[model samples]
Each structure stands twice: as structure tokens, then as C-alpha cells.
Target: MDVYYFTEFPYAEFPESEAEKFPSMRLTFPNTYFDPNKAHDLFKRYLDEYQHAEDVGFDGLMINEHHNTPSCMDVEVNITGGILARTTSKAKILMLGNMLPTSDNPPRLAEEIAMLDVISGGRIVSGFVRGIGIESWANNTNPVYNRERFEECHDLIIKAWTTPGPFRWEGKHYQYRAVNPWMLPIQKPHPPVWVPGTGSPETVEWAAKNRYTYAAFLTPLDVAQGLFARYREYAAADGWEAAPDNFAFMVCCHVNDTEEKAQEAGKAFLWRMNHPLRGPREYWSPPGYTSRAGAAAVAQRRPTPLNELSYEELQSRYHLVVGNPDSVTRQLRHIKDTLGVGALLLEAQGGPLSHHDTMRSLELMGREVIPALKD
Candidate 1:
């Protein structure tokens, strides 16, 4: 299986020794507490290390997008474009991807994607997402219209890339008087389309129907296995062959010589995982957001005043696969076999974990777990 590291580039610092001295690290904390220049340097280090993953024979490098969340360095997709443009050859660069519908000018996405594909010598796997709950508020988009906007945007983007262009196009959400794209992507038809999500049924069906690769983010292995099975069932119903190559799953992983050592290295991260960085509550999803139901049902599943949910509950639900290489291997093998997943996105960086801990985890994963899986 191929492995890709998820980098958040979180600010690294120790908490106050006296509990009473500092206020609690609440959910609404700003993510980039470190100096901007220092964060830039840290990001460069991450890129260098990611390149080393390819050197160690990983299948590819992965990058994602987020905004105003301490969870990641917001706008890293643009950074991915730069990395793919200048970094070493080979190893498909998966922009797992930009929030297309929310972008006022969707064609800019098409243009930038084509530019990146050309610069990277046609190595790019594009993953489109409707984005998450808070994004609605951040982007001034109606969460209610997210699904419609996304479907329309996806069609528009593919058309912009594939059609001869220089034509007028109009849709419910977008309009274009002159539809002429200056550049076409190097990948035939278009770069491979992969969609990432967290067990959304509509997404599963859409991915299955379109034959797009599905990557589940921030979910436990047990749950991910079930989700993948559902995807396969849909693929089968659609009269398609569901193979290992068709799916990918994300795992929050860290490995070391021993489980105890690994736990020690990642305890702070576990603590952070138990901590929620921000919320208006209810996964921050707006009413009537999901395709399966109206805003009321969505609200029921994700209650309002989302802040009421404690950090510990979030951690227990989200954090999984924190152990030694052998333990991680056993868990991953089971999930891979169960889900028929072709690739695994190994997220080594999370919460407030130390960079040293993350680097050590990556090394062990590459040297121990990944090699064993290969054999």
C-alpha cells in the first residue's frame, strides 16, 4: 500500500506548569501562534521531509485545504501547487483538494489545476470536497445550498477542463460569458478525480457512480471499514468492479520501537485530540446541509450550541491508531483487507504533538510498518 503524510505544521510549545496560571486551551484558539516566518521555515522542513518520504519509496505526497482552524495551516493547497511545481519528479501530488463551490471564481481553480498539472509533468490526483461545517460561515456560503453548489461546480470545472472552450455557459450558481481556458491539463481527459469525506452517504454514492477514488478523513479504522464496504456495495450495484486501487482511507498514526514509547511520545497529542479547538457546536454544520435530509434532520444529528460537547468526547471519537509499528500494522492490515483500500493516507501530525515526535513516528512507519506490509 502507498503511504502519504498529513502535515498540520502546528505551533509547538509547552503549557504553563501551573494549571491556574494560564487559561484553559479552549476550542476557539487561533492555530498559528508561532511567528509567521518561523512557521514558513517549519513548512519548508515539512516539505523537505515529505520529499524524503518519496525517496524512501512512498507512492506519493498529499496536501489538503482548511481555513482559520488551528487544525492546519489554512490554504496549504496553494502551497501544494508550489511544491508540485518545484519538487522532485514522480510521486503523484494529490491536492485533496480545494473547496470549489465556495470559491467565487471556480474557473480560477480550473486554471490553477491545469497550471500545476503542466508544471508537475502530469502528476496530480485531484480530490474535491464540499468542505466542512465552519467553512460555511467563513466563506459566507449558505450551508443549505452546499450540495447543489458543489454538484454544479463539479460539472462546471470538468467542463472547463475538457471542453474546447470559448463559449458562453450559465448555471443556477455560476455564469460565464466567455468560457475560454488559456491552458489545458497535461493529463488526458483530466487528472484522476478523488473525493474525500467522512462517511457521508451522498458522497459515497456519488463517488461510486462516477468511479472516483474515495478517501475518508479523520475517522477511526473500524468505522472506515464499514464505510468502505458501503462504497463497494454501491459500486457493485452500479455494475462496476470494485478493486483495491479504487479506494483510500486516512489513519491518524504514529509508530515507534514499542507501544509504550510511542504512547509517551504522543500523549500530549492525545491530550490535544481530546481538546476541541473551536465550535459554534453541532459540527458547525448549517441546517439542511446534507443531501439525505433537510436542515432539521442535519441539525438534530449535529445539535446547536456545539460548544456543549466536551473535548474528551471528540477525542475518543476521532483519535485512533496511536501505538507501536506492530500494533499499527495489525490494525491497518485488518482495515485494508476489510475495506479493499488501495492506499492509506497516514496522518502523522495532529493536535499539539511535538514535531520531533511526528518525525520519529514517520521514520518508524516508513522503516518498520510500511516495509513489513510490502513484504
Candidate 2:
């Protein structure tokens, strides 16, 4: 399995009690708690960690973006991607990824990603996502148009990358008279496109139809299994076969020298499962952001929120893997064998996880856990 390093770049400088003052920690949570100098330091440290992960032998480094929350400091994945492209040499840069629905400029998005692929010497995995419901509120984008915009924006970006330019693009949501980009990806026909989903049938079908990788993010093993099975079924019906490379899994993970030490550090993951995942239902599932079937599937996907699950419960259900090298490797291997995923997107840096702890964990994964998983 290809192990990828990931982090939300969380800012936990403020007291947790402050989040109680708001209905949700997303969208409406005030940024009064933010401090620029601290965030500047964090950005430096986080980028350093990415570089270190590459040096330590991770196969890929994944970056994501979000708005109006301390949950994810990366407000723009492409910006971070550019930084990684220049800084790192070997690891694939997986931006999971551009929020197509919320973007107003598809051509610019295409140009940016193409530039990243070129800068990275073609080691870029382009991921596309329809931003979550809170993104609708954060960007003031109409939720009803979320899927439509996502599809149209995606089409335009792909065309921008693959089709010969200086052409006209007239779509429902985006239009360009001259679709020529000075920059093009080095990868023939464009870089790989991976889509992450969490119990969204439409997403599975869409990704299958286009032969894109479908990554299941933080879903239960059983739920993710069902989702991938659906994707495979779609591929079969289309008279194609889906390989392990067509699937990936994202989960919170950490490792240390000993099980005891690892358990102590693993407590830090609770901070992420807590406030970042906590909020009013409206904040998470705003009207029209998801199709009815998708919404229903989501409701049944997880019996309880990760926030409500105890640490042991989280590990038991495969939502997280926290242990020494041997145990974490065991758990991750089970996930790989159970789901047939080719890549594991490990959120090794999570809420309040100390820098010292994170670096040590990365070191251990590089020296032991990652190699064990490969075996």
C-alpha cells in the first residue's frame, strides 16, 4: 500500500471552551481567536513537516482546504501544493483537493494544478471534491447549485487540461471565450484524478464512469466496503475492471516507540474528533447540499459520530489506528485487505498533537510501520 502523510493543519492555540459560545465551530465561529504570528509559525512548521515526510520515505503527501474553521488551516490546497512541488523531490503531491463547486474560476484552477504537476516533475495527483455543506455558507455559494456547479467546473478543468486550447467553453456555470493555458501538465493527457467520497452513491457512480480513483474518507470499514463495492459494480456494468489503484482510504493515524507511549499521544486525536466534528445539524447538512439518497446513506453510514465514539471504539471500528509500529501496521493492513484500497491517507498530524510527537511518529512510520504495511 502507498502511505500518504496528511494533516488538517489545525490551530488549537485558543481554549476549547470558547467554541461553546457558538452554535457551531464552523462557518459562524468567529476568527477573533486567531493570531497571525502563531499561524505564521504553524505554516512554517507544517510545511517543514511535509518536507520531512518526503525525506523520511512517505509515498505521497496529501493537502486539503477548508474555510471558517480552525479545523483546517489550509484554505487553499493548490497554494500548498506549489510549496510542496518546489520543496519536495520524491513524494507524490496529492491535493484532495480543489473544491470545484465553490470555485468561480475553473480555468485558473486548471492552470494552477497544471503548474503544480509541471513543477513537481509530474508527481501530482489531482483530486476534485464538492465542498461540504458548511462551505456553502462560508463561500455564500447556493447549495442547490452545488452538484451542478461541481460537475460543470470539473468538466471545464479537465477540458482545460486535456483538450487543445484557444477553444470556447460555454457551460451552465462557467464560460470562457479563449480556453488556452500557457501551462500544461507534464503527465500525458493530464495527471491522475482522484475523488474522495463518504457514502455518496452519486459520487461513486460519477467517479466510476470517469475511471477516477474513489477515496473513502473516514467512513467505517463496513460502510466503505459497501461504497467501494458499489463503485466496482458501476465499473463492471460499464464493461470495465477497477484495480486497487482506483481506491484509497483516509483515516486518522499515529505511531510512537511503544504502545504505552503511543496511547498517550493518541489522545490528541480526540481534539479533532471533538469540536471540529461537532456542530448543529444545519451547519453540517444544509439544505440541498446533498441529494436525498446521499443524505440518507450518510445518516446510516456511521452509527454514531466519531466525536461520540470512545478511543477504543474508534480503533475497533477502524476509524483510527493508534499504536506502536507493529499494532498500527496490523490495523492498517487489515484495512487494506478488507477494502482493497491501494493508498492510505494518514492524518498523522491532528488537533493538539505536539510537533515533537508528530515528528517522532513520522520517523517511526518511515523506519518501521510503512515498510511493514508494504510487506
Candidate 3:
């Protein structure tokens, strides 16, 4: 499996208890807590870490975008992708990815991603996502139109990359009289498109139909198995076998010299499972954001909210892996074997994990854990 280093680039500089005052540490959370001077330092450190992950021999670097939350500082993956493209020489740049529904211009989105692919010498994996319910609130995008907009935007972007334009686009959520862009991806038929989900059936089906990779994020092993099985069933219906390359899995990961130190350092990840994920239901799932079936699938997929899981439970569930190099390697290998996935997206940095520990973990992953999994 190809191991990709990822970070939400969390800004956990404040008290976790403070989040209780808002619906969630997201859209409605007050910006009084934001200190730009601190954030300036954070951005620099996180970028440095990304470069280091590549230097240490990670196969890829995955970046994501979010809004109104300290959970993820990257508000625009394209901006980060541009920076990484210019700075890093190797490693796939997976942008998981532009929020199609929240974007107003599909052609612009296509151009920016194409530019990154060009800048990176074809090392780009374009991912499409339906922003979470909170994103609808954050961007003031109508929740009811989320899926529709996502599909339309995806169609337009794909056309912009594949069809030689000045082609006209007329769709339900978007329309363009002239669609032409000088920038095009280095990868023929555009860079590979991947889609992520927590086992949303529609998402799995859509991804399967398009033959795009389906990355299951933070779902338990069993839940991911079921989702991948569903994808296989979809592919079978179309008379083709889905390869392991068709699947990917993402989870929190940290490795140190010993399990004891790893556990201590891994505490930083707890904040990620807590405050940002803690919130009233209304804040997390606004009306119409999820279909009844999708919401039901999500509710049943996990036994409990991530914040409620003890560290041991988290490890047992494979939500997070913190251990010595050998142990971490074993756990990740089990995930690889159990899922038959081609990619492992490792969130090696999270919460307030110190720069020292983050770098150490990445170093160990490069030196030991990643290689073990490869064999």
C-alpha cells in the first residue's frame, strides 16, 4: 500500500473547554479565539512538516480543506496544492479536495487543479467531496442543493479537463457560455479522481460507476469492509472486478521509538476527536443536508462518537494507531490485509502534536513503519 502523510493542520492553541459555548467549534464559533500571529507560525510549521514528510520518503502528501474550524487550518486545498507543487519534487499531491457544492466556478476549480498537476509534473490525485453539513452553514450554500451542485460541478470540471473547450455548459446548478482554459492537467484524461466518504451508499455507488477510487475515512474496519464490498458489487454489476487500487483508507497515525512515548505523544490526537467533533446535532446535521438513508447509515456505522472512545478503545477500533515502529507497522498491515486497499492515508499530525513529535513520527514512519508495510 502506498502510505500518504496527511495533517488537518490543526490549531489547538486555545482551551478545549471553550468549544462548549458554541453549537460546534465550526461555523458559529467566535473568531475571538483566533490569533493571527500564532496562526502565522502554525502555517509555516505545518508546511515545513509536509516538505519533511516527502523528504523522509512518504509516497504522497494529502491535504484537505475546511471552513470555520480549528480542526483544519487549510481553507483552500488548491492554495496549498500550488505551494506544494512548487516546493516538492516527488510525492503525489492528493487534494481530497475541492468542495464542489460550495464552489461557484467549476472552470476556475478545474484550472487551479490543472495548474497544480502541471506544476507537480503529473503527481496529482484530484478528489471530489460533498462538504459536510456544517460547510453548508459556513458557506451559506443551500443544504438542499448540496448533492445536485456537487454532481453538476463535477461534470463541468471533468469536461473542462477532458474536452477541448470553448464548449458551452448548461446544467441545473451552473451554466457557462464559453468554457475554455489554457491550463490542463499533465495526466491524460486529467489526474486520477478519488472520492471520500464515511460509507455513504450513494457516494460509493457514484465512485464505483465512474471507476474513481473510494477512500473510506475513519470508518471502522467492518464498516469499511461493507462499503468496499458494496463497491465491488457495483463493479461486478458492470462486469468488471474492482482492483485493490480502487480503494483507500484513512486514519490517525503516530509512531515513536517506543509504545510508551508514542502513547504520551499521541494524546495530542485526542483533542481532534473531541472538541471539533463535539457539538449539538443541529450544528452537525442541519435539515436536508443528509438523506434519511445516508444519515441512518452513518449513525449505525460507528458504535459511538469518536470523542467518547477511550484511547484503548480508539486503538482497538483502529481509529488511531500509536505505537513503536513494529507495532504500528503490524496494525497498519492488518488494515491493509483486511481491506485490500492500495493506499493508506495517515494523518500523522493532529491536534497539538508538537513539532518535535510530529517530525519524529514521520521520521520513524519513513525509516521503519512504511517499509514494513510495503513488504
Candidate 4:
């Protein structure tokens, strides 16, 4: 199993009457806070912590991309990439990817990533994501066309990385005079590509068809297993014997001497992290957001806006693992045994856990859980 320490770099602020509030703790609340000065130092800590993950023996360190949100730091992948290049060695740097269709120029992404690959001495696990929900609105894209745009963007970027340079290229979403990337990746052909998904049928099918490794983003284990099973079935039918080694699953985790202590810590952090007393009552849906199926499914359960969905609802809808190291390990082992997933994306960030608490969870996993899993 490939162990990874992932960070969300959640924003934090102190209140006179209460503990510091973690911004990325809940999806129900609208981000109504900001401070430019605190951001710099907070980001530095985030980087330090990420580097520490490598020192502690995680096989991989991960960074993701997002924009116009206080939920996560380092909106630009290049900045994160540069920090990782100077920080550590050995651990694969997984940029769970930049949103391709939303990007105006895919070549720029290809070039920058290739450069990072070269600088990192070939430690790059490139992830490709089609921007999610409101991201389409944020990027001024039509969500309906996101899948199509993603496919075209992927093709164009690949050609740019491999083909001889300065070749004219024209595509629906992008047009370029030169088909060559300025910087070629250190890894032959390209860095291994991982695709993160939210259980979309087309995405599952596509990942299987292309033989790309798929990482289940935030779905529950049972659901994740079901989705992987579907992917496995597709792979098998196409003449590939799929095994547990074919997929990756993600889970939120915490650890302590006892389950109660861990739960208390997790709950306390979540409570402190809850920014709003109630949920947002807005469309929250950005234009061109293409989660018609997801939306319909939620509607069947209870008609409500995105922001209004209750905390319990979110947990039920998405399988989020929250428990001590042993409990977490058991759940993961169950997933591996039943679902046949080979790797895990351990989300070092829970909805509202502090840096101290997050590190504790990570350390416990490294010291106790990982060894057991390996056995």
C-alpha cells in the first residue's frame, strides 16, 4: 500500500470568547471571514507540516488546487510545486491535479508540471480533475461541457508533452501554433497520472478504458467499493483481470489512546470549525455546474439547497471515515479485503482538526496503523 499525507491547509482565526475557528471545517457554512496578513504565516506552517509528512515516512505528499475560497491555501499549483521541490525528497508529490477544462491554456499546465517533475528528480503523480460543481462558475465555464472539455484538454496536453515542438494544433477548447512543451518531464513518456472522481459512471468507465489509476475522492467505503467494483467489472470485461491493487480510496482519520478521546478531539475541532450557526440558503450552485444526477439523488432524499444540507446529511451522502488508528485501519482493511483497492489517500485534514491534532493522527497512523496494514 502507498501511504500519503494530504493537507487541506485550512484557514484559522481566533475569537476572544472561543478557540480558533478553522475555515475548511464544514461545507454547510459560507466563508464569511478574511485576513490577508495571517495568510502568509499560515501558508508557511502548512508547507512545513507537509514537508514533515515526508520526514515521517509517508510514501507520498499531496497538494490540490482550488480558487476563490478561504477553505484551502495555495490556490496555484505552481507555488505549491515550488515549495515541495525545495522541501523534501523520496515522497512522490501528487498534484491531485489542476482543473484542465477551466484552464484557458493546457500547454502552460503541461509545461509547468513537466518542469516540476524535472526539479523534483521525477517524483510527480499528476492528477487530472474536471472542475467540480461551482468551480465551473468560478472559472467562467459551462459545467455541461466540462466532460467534453476535459477530454479535449487531456489529449492536447499529452500531445504537447510528447510530440515534436512548434507544430500547429487546433482543438475545440484550445488553439496553439506550437504543439511542443518547453520543458519535458523527467519521467519517460510522462509522470504517472491518477484521476480523482466522485462516482460518475462516465468517469469510472473512462478511467478503466484508459488504464489510469482512479482515486475515489470523498465517497463512503461501501459506495467507494461499489464504484470500484463497477470499474473492475469494466476492466475485466475488457480483458484486464482487475484486482484490489487497481484503485485508491480516501478517508478522514484521527487517533488517540482511546476511541472516546479521539472522538472528543474530532468533535471539538469540528464544533470550533463550524463558522455558521446555520447553513447558507443560496443557490450556491455556480452556473454550468453539472451534477444533475447527484442533485437529483439528493432531491429524492430531501429537497434543499447546497448550503442548507445538514452536517449529518453530508456524512451519510459521502462516506467520511472518522475514528482512532485501529478503527481506521480496520475500516481500510475491510475496504481492501472487500473492495480490492490497493492504495489509500489519507486526508491529513479532517473538517476542523488543528495542525497539532492532524499531526497526531498522522504520526499514530505512521507508527501503529501502517505497520499493521503492511502485515
Candidate 5:
């Protein structure tokens, strides 16, 4: 399995308690807490970490974007994707990914990704996402049109990359009279597309229909297994057998030289599991943002929220993994074996995880954990 290193590129210099003053840490939380100076330093440190992860033998580097949130300072993945493309030579740059529904221009989105692929010498895995409900508010996009815009924007971007453009696009959510961009992806058809989901049935079915990899983000192992099984059912109906490469699993992971030290450092993930995830139902799931079926699946999959779970419960559920190299490798391998996924997107760094601990964990993962899994 390909092991990818990931971080939300968090900006957690502020006190976690500040989130209590707002409905959530995401959309409505005031940016008054933001310190440009601290963020400047954090950005440099995080970029350095990304470069180091590549140097230490990670197969890929993953970055994501979110707006108005301290949990993830990266507001634009393409910007960081371009930087990683130039700085790293070998690691696949997985942008999981650009938000489809919130974007107004599909052709521009296509060009930006294509440019990154060219710059990276064809090492880009393009990930498409239907932004969370908070994003719909932040971008002022209608929640009712979330799924419609997501599908239409995706269709247009794919056409921009593959179909010889100069063609016209007339769709419900997107329209372009002349559809051609001078820049095209270095990868032949386009970069490999991956979609991240957490118990969204329509997402799984859509991904399977396109033969795209479906990454289950932070979902329980059993839930991920079920989602993958559904994907297989879809693929089988289409007369193609899905392989491990068609699926990926993402979880927060940390490794150190000793189990005790790893466990202690792993507690840093609690910051992420808590405040940022606390919000009203409307903030997280606007009325039309999710179908009734999707919401039901999500509730069944995660009956207890991560914030409500103790650290031990989190570990037991596989939402977070922390241990010495040997133990981490064993747990990750079990996930790989159980889900039959092609890749593991490990959030090796998360909320308030210090630079020293993050680097040390990355080093240990490269030296011991990753190789052990490969064997």
C-alpha cells in the first residue's frame, strides 16, 4: 500500500477555549483570534515538514483547504499543491482536494490542477470534494444546490481535461460557450481522481461509477469496509472488478520510539477532535446539504461523535492510531488487510502537534512503520 503523509496545516496558536464563544470553530468563529505573525511561522514550519516527509520516504504528500477555520490554515490546496510540486521531486502530490460545489469556474479549476500536474511531472492525484455544510455558508452557495453543483462542476472539469475542448458546455449549474484551456494536465487522461467520504452513500456510488478511488476519511474501519463493499457491488454491476487501488483510508496516526511517548503526543489530536467539530446541526448539515439517506448512513456509522469519545475509545475505534513503530505498523496493516485499500492517508500531524513530535513521528514512520507494512 502507498502510505501518504497528511496534515491540515493547522493554525492553532490561539487558545482552544476561544471556540466556546462562537457556534463553531469553522465558519462563524471570528478571525480576530488569527495572528498573521504566528501563521507566518507556522506556514514555514509546516512546509518544511512536508518537504521532510518526502525526503524520509513517504510515497505521497496530502494537503487540503478550508476557509475561516483555525484547524486548517490552508485555505487553498492548489496554492500549496503548486509549492509542493516545485519543492518535492518524487512524492505524489495528493490534493484531497478542491471543493467542487463552491467553485464557480470549472475550467479555471481544471487549469489550476493541470498546471500543478505539469509542474509535478505528472505526480498529482486530483481529489474532488463536496464541501461540508459550513462551506456552503462560507462560500454563500445554496445548500439545496450542493449536490447538483458538485456533479455538474465535476462533469465540466472532467470534460475540460479529457474531451478536446473548444466545445461548448451548457449545464444547469455551469455554462461556458467556449471550453478550452491552453494548459492541460501532464497525465494523459488527467490526474487520478479520488473522493473522500464519511458514510455518504451517493458519494460511494458516484465514485464507483467513474472508477475513481473513494477515500473514507476518519470513518470507523467497519464503516469503511461496508462502503468499499458497496463500491465493489457497483463496480461488479458495471462488469469490472475493483482492486485495492480503487480505495483509500485516512486516519490520524503518530509514531515514536516508545509506546508511552507516542501515546502522550497522540493526545494533541484531541484539539482537532473537539472544538472544531462542535457546532449546531444546521452549521454542520444544512437542511438540503445531505439527503435523508446520507444523514441516516452517517448517524449509523458514527453514532458517537469523536469529541464525545475518550482517547482510548478513539484509539479503539481506529480514528486515531498512536504507538511505537512496531505497534503502529501492525494496526495500519490490519486496516489495509481489512479494507483492502490501496493507500493509507495518515494525518501524521494535527491540531497543536508540535514540530519536534511531528518530525520525529515522520522519521519513525519512514524508518520502521512504512517499510514494515510494505513487507
Candidate 6:
């Protein structure tokens, strides 16, 4: 299995208690807490961390974007993707990814990703996402049109990459009279596409239909297994058998010299599990953002939220893994065996996880854990 290193590129220099003053630490959470100077230092440190992860032995580097949240400072993945493309030579740059629904221009989105792929020498995995409800509000996109826009934008971007453009696009959510762009991806049919989800049924079906990898982000192992099974069912119906490469599992993971030290450092993830996840139902799930069935699946998939779970509970459920190299490798291997996933996307850095701990974890993962799993 490919071991990919990931971080939200968090800007958590502010006190966690500040989130209590707002409805949630998301859309309405004031940016008055943001400090440009602190962020400047953090951006440098985080970029160094990404470069180091590649230097060690990680197969890929994963970066994501979010607006109006301290949990992820990277507001644009393509920009970061471009940086990683130039800085690192071996690791695949996975941008999980540009938000399709919120974007008004599919052709521009296509050009940006294509440019990154070109810069990266074809090592780009383009991950498309249906932005969370908070994203709909931040981008001022209608929640009701989220799915429609996502599909249409995705179709247009794919066409821009694959078909000989100069073609016209007329769709409900997007329209272009002349679709032609000089920038095209280095990868032949465009970079590989991956989609991340928690428990959305439609997302699984959609990913399976396109034969793109479906990454289950922070979902319980059992829940991920069920989602993968459903993907297989869809693929089987289409007369193709899905392989491990068709699926990926993402989780918070940390490794250290000892289990005790790892456990202590793992507490840093609680900052991410807590405030940022605390929000009203509407902020998290606008009325039309999710179908009734999708919502039901999500509710059933995670009866207890990550914030509500204790550290031990989180570890027991596989939402977070912390240990020495041997132990972490065992746990991650179990996940790989159980879900039959092709990749493990490990969030090595999260809310307030210090640079010392983060680098140590990455070093140990590269030195011991990753190789053990491969064996």
C-alpha cells in the first residue's frame, strides 16, 4: 500500500477557547484571531515539513483547502500543489482538491490542475470534492445546487482535459461558448481522480461509476469497509471487479520512539476533533446540501461524533492511531487488510501538533512503520 503524508496545514496559533464565542469555528468564526506574522512562520514550517516527508520516504504528499477555518490554513490546494510539484521530485502530489461546486469556472480549474501536473512531471492525483455545507456558505453557493454544480463542473473539467477542446459546453450549472485552453495536463487522460467522503452513498456510487478511487476520510473502519463493499457492488454491476487501488482510507496517525510519548502527543488532535467540528446543524448540513438518504447514511455511519469520543475511544475505533513504530505499523496494516485499500492517507500533523512531534512522527513512520507495512 502507498503511504501518503498529509496535514491540514493548520493555523492554530490562537487559543482554542476563542471558538466558544462564535456559533462554530467555521463560517462565522471571526478572522480577527488570525495573525499574518504568525501564519507567515507557520507557512514556512509547514512547507518544510512537506518537503521532509518526501525526503524521508513517503510515496505521496496530500494537501487540502478550506476557507474560514483555522483548522486548515491552505485556502487553495492548487497553489500548494504547485509548490510541492517544484520542491519535491519523487512524491506524488495529491490535491484533495479543488472544490468543484463552489467554482464558477470549470475551464480555469482545469487549467490550474493541468499546470500543476505539467510542473510535477505527471505526478498529480486530482481529488475532487463536494465542499462541506460550511463551504457552500463561505462561497455563497446555493446548497440546493451543490450536487448539480459539482457534476457539471466535473464534466466540463474532464472534457477540457480529455477531448480536443474548442468545443462548446452548455449545462445547467456551467456554460461556455468556446472551451479551449492551452494548458493541458501532462498525464494522458488527465491526472488520476480521487474523491473523499465520510458516508455519502451517492458519492460512492458516483466514484465507482467513474472508476476513480474513493477515499474514506476519518470514518470508522467498519463504515469504510461497508462503503467499499458498496463500491464493489456498483463496479460488479458494471462488469468490472474493483481492486485495492480503487479505494483509500484516511486517518489521524502519529508515531514516536515510544508508545507513551506518541499517546501524549496524540492529544493535539483533540483540538481538531473538537472546536472546528462544533457547529450548528445548518452550518454543517444545510437543508438541501445532503439528500435524506445521504444524511441517514451519515448518521448511521457515525452515531457518535469524533469530538464526543475520548482519546481511548478514538484509538479503539481507528479514528486516530498513535504508537511506537511496531504498534502503529500493526494497526495500519490491520486497516489495510480489513478494508483492502490501496493507500493509507495519514494526517501526521493536526491542530497544535508541534513541529518537533510532527517531524519525529514522520521520521519514525518513514524509518520503521511504512516499510513494515509494505513487507
**Model-by-model lDDT, in order?**
0.70, 0.92, 0.93, 0.70, 0.93, 0.94
The stretch of ten residues in a row with the least summed lDDT in candidate 6 is 9-18
Residue clash pairs of candidate 5: none
lDDT value, candidate 4, whole model: 0.70
Model 3 lDDT, residue 80, Cα:
95
RMSD for each of the candidates = 4.1, 0.8, 0.9, 4.2, 0.8, 0.7
Structural similarity to truth (TM-score) of each candidate: 0.85, 0.99, 0.99, 0.85, 0.99, 0.99
Off by over 4 Å in 3: none
- Candidate 6, residue 341: Cα displacement in angstroms equals 0.3
For model 5, how many clashes?
Answer: 0
lDDT of 4 at 3: 76
Q: Write the per-residue lDDT of candidate 1 for residues 235-353, one digit (tens) a residue.
A: 88888888877789876677777878876765555533433334344445566566544344333433422223343343344445667888888777876776678888877776566
159, model 4: CA deviation in Å? 1.4
Question: What TM-score does candidate 5 reach?
Answer: 0.99
Determine which window of 10 residues in candidate 3 has minimal summed lDDT.
Answer: 277-286
- Residue pairs with backbone overlap in model 1: 27-277, 27-278, 31-70, 281-306, 282-306, 287-295, 288-295
* lDDT over C-alpha atoms for residue 150 of model 1: 86
lDDT of 4 by residue, 1-375 (tens): 877777666665644122234332234234455576777778777787787778767788888876655556657776797679778888899888778878888888889889999999999888898865546655768776888889998888778777778888788778887667779999988888788876576788888887788998756556677678788889999999766556887655566667776766655334322442222222234444545674554345334432344444534343444567788678667766765677777766653566687777777877877777878
Question: How well does candidate 4 score on lDDT at residue 212?
Answer: 82
lDDT score, candidate 6 = 0.94
TM-score computed on alpha carbons, candidate 4: 0.85
The runs of at least 3 residues in candidate 4 whose Cα sits more than 4 Å from the true structure, single-residue gaps closed, are 14-32, 268-288, 291-318
Q: lDDT: which is higher, 1 or 6?
A: 6
lDDT of 6 by residue, 50-86 (tens): 9999988999999999999989999999999989999
Ten-residue stretch with the least lDDT total in model 1: 16-25
Clashing residue pairs found in predicted model 2 = none
Angstrom error at residue 185, model 3? 0.7
